[model samples]
Target: MADGTTDQGPVTMLATPISLDFEFTPGVAQSKFLRGLERGEFLGQRCGTCGQVYVPSRGTCPTDGVATTEDVVLGNSGTVTTYCVVNVPFAGQAIEIPYICAQILLDGANLSFMGLLQEIPTDQIRMGMRVEAVWVDEAELIPSLASVKYFRPNGEPDADYDTYKEYL
Candidate 1:
Protein backbone atom coordinates (compact mmCIF):
# COMPACT_ATOMS: atom_id res chain seq x y z
CA MET A 1 0.00 0.00 0.00
CA ALA A 2 1.14 3.54 -0.76
CA ASP A 3 1.83 5.91 2.12
CA GLY A 4 -1.54 7.78 2.18
CA THR A 5 -3.50 5.61 -0.33
CA THR A 6 -5.57 2.61 0.69
CA ASP A 7 -4.77 -0.79 -0.90
CA GLN A 8 -6.77 -0.58 -4.18
CA GLY A 9 -4.89 -3.16 -6.24
CA PRO A 10 -5.86 -3.04 -9.97
CA VAL A 11 -8.22 -0.53 -11.57
CA THR A 12 -9.93 -3.35 -13.46
CA MET A 13 -9.87 -7.13 -13.48
CA LEU A 14 -9.46 -9.24 -16.63
CA ALA A 15 -12.68 -10.33 -18.24
CA THR A 16 -13.44 -14.04 -18.58
CA PRO A 17 -13.68 -15.45 -22.07
CA ILE A 18 -17.24 -16.12 -23.17
CA SER A 19 -18.49 -19.34 -24.83
CA LEU A 20 -22.12 -19.60 -25.98
CA ASP A 21 -23.68 -22.99 -26.68
CA PHE A 22 -27.32 -23.93 -26.67
CA GLU A 23 -29.73 -26.17 -28.56
CA PHE A 24 -33.03 -24.76 -29.78
CA THR A 25 -35.99 -27.08 -29.33
CA PRO A 26 -38.59 -25.73 -31.67
CA GLY A 27 -42.18 -26.15 -30.69
CA VAL A 28 -44.58 -27.88 -33.09
CA ALA A 29 -45.58 -24.59 -34.68
CA GLN A 30 -42.00 -23.37 -35.05
CA SER A 31 -40.76 -26.72 -36.33
CA LYS A 32 -43.34 -26.72 -39.08
CA PHE A 33 -42.44 -23.16 -40.05
CA LEU A 34 -38.76 -24.03 -40.22
CA ARG A 35 -39.41 -27.06 -42.38
CA GLY A 36 -41.45 -24.93 -44.75
CA LEU A 37 -38.59 -22.46 -45.08
CA GLU A 38 -36.21 -25.26 -45.99
CA ARG A 39 -38.53 -25.98 -48.92
CA GLY A 40 -38.49 -22.35 -50.09
CA GLU A 41 -42.00 -21.74 -48.79
CA PHE A 42 -43.42 -18.98 -46.64
CA LEU A 43 -45.74 -20.38 -44.03
CA GLY A 44 -48.20 -18.56 -41.79
CA GLN A 45 -50.89 -19.61 -39.40
CA ARG A 46 -54.43 -18.44 -40.05
CA CYS A 47 -57.02 -17.59 -37.46
CA GLY A 48 -60.15 -19.61 -37.95
CA THR A 49 -62.34 -17.04 -36.21
CA CYS A 50 -61.32 -13.86 -38.03
CA GLY A 51 -59.33 -15.25 -41.00
CA GLN A 52 -56.26 -13.20 -40.13
CA VAL A 53 -52.88 -14.64 -41.11
CA TYR A 54 -49.54 -14.33 -39.35
CA VAL A 55 -46.15 -14.87 -40.90
CA PRO A 56 -43.55 -16.72 -38.81
CA SER A 57 -46.51 -18.89 -37.83
CA ARG A 58 -47.73 -17.70 -34.50
CA GLY A 59 -49.65 -20.22 -32.44
CA THR A 60 -52.25 -17.60 -31.59
CA CYS A 61 -53.96 -14.82 -33.48
CA PRO A 62 -53.55 -11.27 -32.23
CA THR A 63 -56.84 -10.16 -33.75
CA ASP A 64 -59.32 -12.69 -32.36
CA GLY A 65 -57.09 -13.76 -29.49
CA VAL A 66 -57.52 -17.44 -30.34
CA ALA A 67 -55.19 -20.30 -31.20
CA THR A 68 -54.59 -20.90 -34.90
CA THR A 69 -54.10 -24.16 -36.78
CA GLU A 70 -54.52 -23.31 -40.46
CA ASP A 71 -51.28 -23.01 -42.42
CA VAL A 72 -51.12 -20.64 -45.37
CA VAL A 73 -48.32 -19.91 -47.81
CA LEU A 74 -47.73 -16.24 -48.46
CA GLY A 75 -46.82 -15.31 -52.03
CA ASN A 76 -43.32 -14.17 -52.91
CA SER A 77 -44.28 -10.79 -54.39
CA GLY A 78 -45.94 -8.02 -52.47
CA THR A 79 -46.27 -4.27 -52.05
CA VAL A 80 -44.08 -2.33 -49.70
CA THR A 81 -46.26 -1.07 -46.89
CA THR A 82 -43.58 1.15 -45.36
CA TYR A 83 -39.82 1.33 -44.78
CA CYS A 84 -36.93 3.08 -43.08
CA VAL A 85 -33.43 3.82 -44.31
CA VAL A 86 -30.90 2.27 -41.94
CA ASN A 87 -27.96 4.67 -41.84
CA VAL A 88 -26.40 3.18 -38.72
CA PRO A 89 -24.28 0.06 -38.71
CA PHE A 90 -25.38 -2.81 -36.50
CA ALA A 91 -23.58 -5.90 -35.29
CA GLY A 92 -24.32 -9.07 -37.35
CA GLN A 93 -26.03 -7.10 -40.09
CA ALA A 94 -24.88 -8.41 -43.47
CA ILE A 95 -25.32 -5.20 -45.49
CA GLU A 96 -23.85 -1.75 -44.88
CA ILE A 97 -25.82 1.21 -43.66
CA PRO A 98 -27.84 3.60 -45.85
CA TYR A 99 -29.83 0.54 -46.96
CA ILE A 100 -33.60 0.34 -46.77
CA CYS A 101 -35.47 -1.99 -44.46
CA ALA A 102 -39.09 -2.44 -45.44
CA GLN A 103 -42.36 -4.01 -44.38
CA ILE A 104 -43.97 -5.89 -47.25
CA LEU A 105 -47.53 -7.17 -47.50
CA LEU A 106 -47.37 -10.44 -49.39
CA ASP A 107 -50.12 -11.29 -51.82
CA GLY A 108 -52.98 -13.41 -50.44
CA ALA A 109 -51.84 -12.67 -46.90
CA ASN A 110 -53.33 -10.10 -44.56
CA LEU A 111 -50.10 -9.27 -42.71
CA SER A 112 -46.74 -7.70 -43.45
CA PHE A 113 -43.20 -8.97 -42.84
CA MET A 114 -39.98 -6.99 -42.44
CA GLY A 115 -37.09 -7.56 -44.88
CA LEU A 116 -34.16 -5.84 -46.53
CA LEU A 117 -34.45 -4.01 -49.85
CA GLN A 118 -31.93 -4.12 -52.68
CA GLU A 119 -31.43 -3.92 -56.53
CA ILE A 120 -32.79 -0.37 -56.55
CA PRO A 121 -31.67 3.07 -55.56
CA THR A 122 -32.32 3.89 -51.94
CA ASP A 123 -33.76 7.24 -53.03
CA GLN A 124 -36.26 5.39 -55.21
CA ILE A 125 -37.53 3.25 -52.36
CA ARG A 126 -41.04 4.52 -51.74
CA MET A 127 -44.11 3.24 -50.01
CA GLY A 128 -46.17 0.71 -52.02
CA MET A 129 -43.31 -0.20 -54.30
CA ARG A 130 -43.79 -3.72 -55.65
CA VAL A 131 -41.11 -6.08 -54.37
CA GLU A 132 -40.37 -9.78 -54.60
CA ALA A 133 -38.46 -12.18 -52.45
CA VAL A 134 -34.94 -13.09 -53.53
CA TRP A 135 -34.39 -16.58 -52.20
CA VAL A 136 -30.97 -18.03 -51.52
CA ASP A 137 -29.89 -20.94 -53.70
CA GLU A 138 -31.39 -24.36 -52.94
CA ALA A 139 -28.06 -25.62 -51.65
CA GLU A 140 -28.10 -22.90 -48.96
CA LEU A 141 -31.46 -23.78 -47.45
CA ILE A 142 -31.79 -23.15 -43.74
CA PRO A 143 -34.55 -23.05 -41.15
CA SER A 144 -34.51 -19.28 -40.92
CA LEU A 145 -35.84 -16.17 -42.64
CA ALA A 146 -32.30 -15.51 -43.85
CA SER A 147 -32.98 -18.31 -46.34
CA VAL A 148 -34.61 -15.57 -48.36
CA LYS A 149 -31.74 -13.19 -48.93
CA TYR A 150 -33.77 -9.97 -49.40
CA PHE A 151 -36.52 -8.22 -51.32
CA ARG A 152 -36.01 -6.38 -54.56
CA PRO A 153 -38.16 -4.17 -56.75
CA ASN A 154 -39.98 -6.30 -59.37
CA GLY A 155 -40.05 -3.58 -62.04
CA GLU A 156 -43.77 -3.17 -61.45
CA PRO A 157 -45.45 0.18 -61.09
CA ASP A 158 -45.76 1.45 -57.57
CA ALA A 159 -49.20 1.43 -56.05
CA ASP A 160 -50.77 4.51 -54.50
CA TYR A 161 -49.92 5.11 -50.88
CA ASP A 162 -53.62 4.98 -49.96
CA THR A 163 -53.82 1.43 -51.32
CA TYR A 164 -51.64 0.00 -48.56
CA LYS A 165 -51.71 2.90 -46.11
CA GLU A 166 -53.90 1.11 -43.57
CA TYR A 167 -51.52 -1.88 -43.49
CA LEU A 168 -48.72 0.33 -42.22
Candidate 2:
Protein backbone atom coordinates (compact mmCIF):
# COMPACT_ATOMS: atom_id res chain seq x y z
CA MET A 1 0.00 0.00 0.00
CA ALA A 2 2.92 2.36 0.65
CA ASP A 3 4.43 1.78 -2.84
CA GLY A 4 2.92 3.71 -5.74
CA THR A 5 3.55 0.89 -8.24
CA THR A 6 1.21 -2.06 -8.51
CA ASP A 7 1.31 -5.52 -10.18
CA GLN A 8 -1.25 -4.42 -12.74
CA GLY A 9 0.45 -2.55 -15.62
CA PRO A 10 -2.61 -0.54 -16.73
CA VAL A 11 -6.27 -0.07 -16.00
CA THR A 12 -9.01 -0.14 -18.63
CA MET A 13 -12.52 0.92 -17.75
CA LEU A 14 -15.44 -0.10 -19.91
CA ALA A 15 -18.13 2.43 -20.51
CA THR A 16 -21.55 1.73 -19.04
CA PRO A 17 -24.07 0.92 -21.76
CA ILE A 18 -27.40 2.68 -21.89
CA SER A 19 -30.41 2.92 -24.14
CA LEU A 20 -32.35 6.02 -25.30
CA ASP A 21 -35.42 6.37 -27.45
CA PHE A 22 -37.05 9.37 -29.02
CA GLU A 23 -39.32 10.33 -31.88
CA PHE A 24 -38.06 12.72 -34.54
CA THR A 25 -39.91 14.58 -37.19
CA PRO A 26 -38.14 14.90 -40.54
CA GLY A 27 -39.55 18.13 -41.91
CA VAL A 28 -40.56 18.78 -45.50
CA ALA A 29 -37.17 18.97 -47.21
CA GLN A 30 -35.67 16.33 -44.95
CA SER A 31 -38.62 14.00 -45.47
CA LYS A 32 -38.14 14.23 -49.21
CA PHE A 33 -34.47 13.39 -48.85
CA LEU A 34 -35.23 10.40 -46.62
CA ARG A 35 -37.89 9.11 -49.03
CA GLY A 36 -35.33 9.29 -51.82
CA LEU A 37 -32.97 7.09 -49.83
CA GLU A 38 -35.78 4.56 -49.30
CA ARG A 39 -36.17 4.27 -53.07
CA GLY A 40 -32.40 3.97 -53.69
CA GLU A 41 -32.26 7.47 -55.07
CA PHE A 42 -29.57 9.95 -54.07
CA LEU A 43 -31.45 13.19 -53.62
CA GLY A 44 -30.44 16.74 -52.79
CA GLN A 45 -32.16 20.09 -52.63
CA ARG A 46 -30.99 23.13 -54.61
CA CYS A 47 -31.26 26.66 -53.30
CA GLY A 48 -33.58 28.71 -55.44
CA THR A 49 -31.11 31.61 -55.31
CA CYS A 50 -27.49 30.31 -55.32
CA GLY A 51 -28.25 27.00 -56.99
CA GLN A 52 -26.13 25.26 -54.36
CA VAL A 53 -27.32 21.74 -53.54
CA TYR A 54 -27.36 19.98 -50.19
CA VAL A 55 -27.93 16.34 -49.30
CA PRO A 56 -30.26 15.57 -46.40
CA SER A 57 -30.99 19.24 -46.58
CA ARG A 58 -32.02 21.25 -43.50
CA GLY A 59 -34.90 22.75 -45.51
CA THR A 60 -32.96 25.94 -46.27
CA CYS A 61 -29.64 26.98 -47.76
CA PRO A 62 -26.94 28.00 -45.31
CA THR A 63 -25.53 30.66 -47.56
CA ASP A 64 -28.65 32.16 -49.12
CA GLY A 65 -30.95 31.45 -46.17
CA VAL A 66 -33.70 30.53 -48.63
CA ALA A 67 -35.90 27.48 -48.81
CA THR A 68 -34.51 24.62 -50.92
CA THR A 69 -37.56 23.20 -52.63
CA GLU A 70 -36.19 21.93 -55.92
CA ASP A 71 -35.40 18.21 -55.70
CA VAL A 72 -32.18 17.31 -57.49
CA VAL A 73 -31.30 13.69 -58.01
CA LEU A 74 -27.56 13.16 -57.66
CA GLY A 75 -25.41 10.18 -58.56
CA ASN A 76 -23.78 7.76 -56.17
CA SER A 77 -20.28 8.70 -57.29
CA GLY A 78 -18.23 11.54 -55.84
CA THR A 79 -14.73 12.85 -55.09
CA VAL A 80 -12.94 12.83 -51.76
CA THR A 81 -12.21 16.40 -50.83
CA THR A 82 -10.54 15.72 -47.48
CA TYR A 83 -10.14 12.87 -45.04
CA CYS A 84 -8.66 11.46 -41.83
CA VAL A 85 -7.48 7.98 -40.91
CA VAL A 86 -9.14 6.62 -37.78
CA ASN A 87 -6.14 5.18 -36.00
CA VAL A 88 -7.52 5.37 -32.46
CA PRO A 89 -9.89 2.71 -31.20
CA PHE A 90 -12.88 3.59 -29.03
CA ALA A 91 -15.55 1.80 -27.08
CA GLY A 92 -18.50 0.38 -29.11
CA GLN A 93 -16.80 1.06 -32.42
CA ALA A 94 -17.61 -1.70 -34.91
CA ILE A 95 -15.10 -0.77 -37.56
CA GLU A 96 -11.47 -1.80 -37.37
CA ILE A 97 -8.82 0.76 -36.63
CA PRO A 98 -7.17 2.76 -39.42
CA TYR A 99 -10.28 3.40 -41.50
CA ILE A 100 -10.62 6.45 -43.73
CA CYS A 101 -13.33 9.03 -43.01
CA ALA A 102 -13.60 11.56 -45.76
CA GLN A 103 -15.72 14.48 -46.84
CA ILE A 104 -17.10 13.49 -50.22
CA LEU A 105 -18.29 16.05 -52.75
CA LEU A 106 -20.97 14.21 -54.65
CA ASP A 107 -21.33 14.97 -58.34
CA GLY A 108 -23.29 18.15 -59.16
CA ALA A 109 -23.53 19.11 -55.45
CA ASN A 110 -21.80 22.20 -54.16
CA LEU A 111 -21.48 20.98 -50.58
CA SER A 112 -19.58 17.96 -49.29
CA PHE A 113 -20.77 15.37 -46.73
CA MET A 114 -18.89 12.97 -44.52
CA GLY A 115 -18.77 9.32 -45.54
CA LEU A 116 -16.73 6.22 -44.86
CA LEU A 117 -14.14 5.30 -47.49
CA GLN A 118 -13.07 1.70 -48.03
CA GLU A 119 -11.92 -0.97 -50.57
CA ILE A 120 -8.67 1.03 -51.05
CA PRO A 121 -5.63 1.04 -48.83
CA THR A 122 -5.49 3.90 -46.34
CA ASP A 123 -2.01 4.83 -47.54
CA GLN A 124 -3.39 5.53 -51.02
CA ILE A 125 -6.26 7.79 -49.88
CA ARG A 126 -5.94 11.40 -50.94
CA MET A 127 -7.88 14.50 -51.91
CA GLY A 128 -9.77 14.46 -55.19
CA MET A 129 -9.87 10.67 -55.25
CA ARG A 130 -12.89 9.47 -57.19
CA VAL A 131 -15.23 7.11 -55.36
CA GLU A 132 -18.72 5.62 -55.46
CA ALA A 133 -21.28 4.50 -52.93
CA VAL A 134 -21.69 0.84 -51.97
CA TRP A 135 -25.39 0.50 -51.28
CA VAL A 136 -26.99 -2.17 -49.17
CA ASP A 137 -29.23 -4.91 -50.59
CA GLU A 138 -32.43 -3.58 -52.16
CA ALA A 139 -34.67 -5.25 -49.58
CA GLU A 140 -32.58 -4.04 -46.65
CA LEU A 141 -32.55 -0.36 -47.59
CA ILE A 142 -34.57 2.14 -45.56
CA PRO A 143 -35.20 5.86 -45.32
CA SER A 144 -31.80 6.55 -43.85
CA LEU A 145 -28.25 7.26 -44.92
CA ALA A 146 -27.40 3.77 -43.66
CA SER A 147 -28.75 2.54 -47.02
CA VAL A 148 -25.29 3.37 -48.37
CA LYS A 149 -22.90 1.08 -46.58
CA TYR A 150 -19.72 2.85 -47.58
CA PHE A 151 -17.78 4.24 -50.52
CA ARG A 152 -15.08 2.62 -52.63
CA PRO A 153 -12.84 3.66 -55.46
CA ASN A 154 -14.57 3.93 -58.85
CA GLY A 155 -11.35 3.59 -60.95
CA GLU A 156 -11.90 7.08 -62.34
CA PRO A 157 -9.30 9.81 -62.72
CA ASP A 158 -8.86 12.17 -59.76
CA ALA A 159 -10.68 15.48 -59.83
CA ASP A 160 -8.66 18.63 -60.36
CA TYR A 161 -7.93 20.84 -57.34
CA ASP A 162 -9.88 23.67 -58.93
CA THR A 163 -13.03 21.56 -58.79
CA TYR A 164 -13.05 21.10 -54.99
CA LYS A 165 -10.69 23.78 -53.64
CA GLU A 166 -13.42 26.06 -52.42
CA TYR A 167 -14.97 23.21 -50.46
CA LEU A 168 -11.77 22.50 -48.58
Top TM-score prediction, candidate number: 2
Q: Report every candidate's CA lDDT.
A: 0.86, 0.92
Distance from true location, Cα of 105 in model 2, Å: 0.3
> Candidate 2 — which residues are off by over 4 angstroms?
1-19
State the RMSD for candidate 1. 5.2
User: Which ranges of candidate 1 are over 4 A from the true structure?
Assistant: 1-21, 91-93
Q: For residue 146, give model 1's deviation from the true position in Å.
A: 1.5
TM-score on alpha carbons, each prediction: 0.82, 0.88
On residues 89-130, what C-alpha lDDT tens digit does candidate 1 reach at each position? Answer: 876787877899999988777778899999888889888899
Model 2: which ten-residue window has the lowest total lDDT? Answer: 1-10
- Candidate 1: what lDDT? 0.86
Name the 10 consecutive residues with the lowest summed lDDT in model 1.
1-10
Please, what are the lDDT tens digits per residue for candidate 2 over residues 4-116? 76776566887778989999998898888888988888899999999888986888999988888899999889999999999999987999989999999999888899999
How far out, in Å, is residue 74 in model 2? 0.6
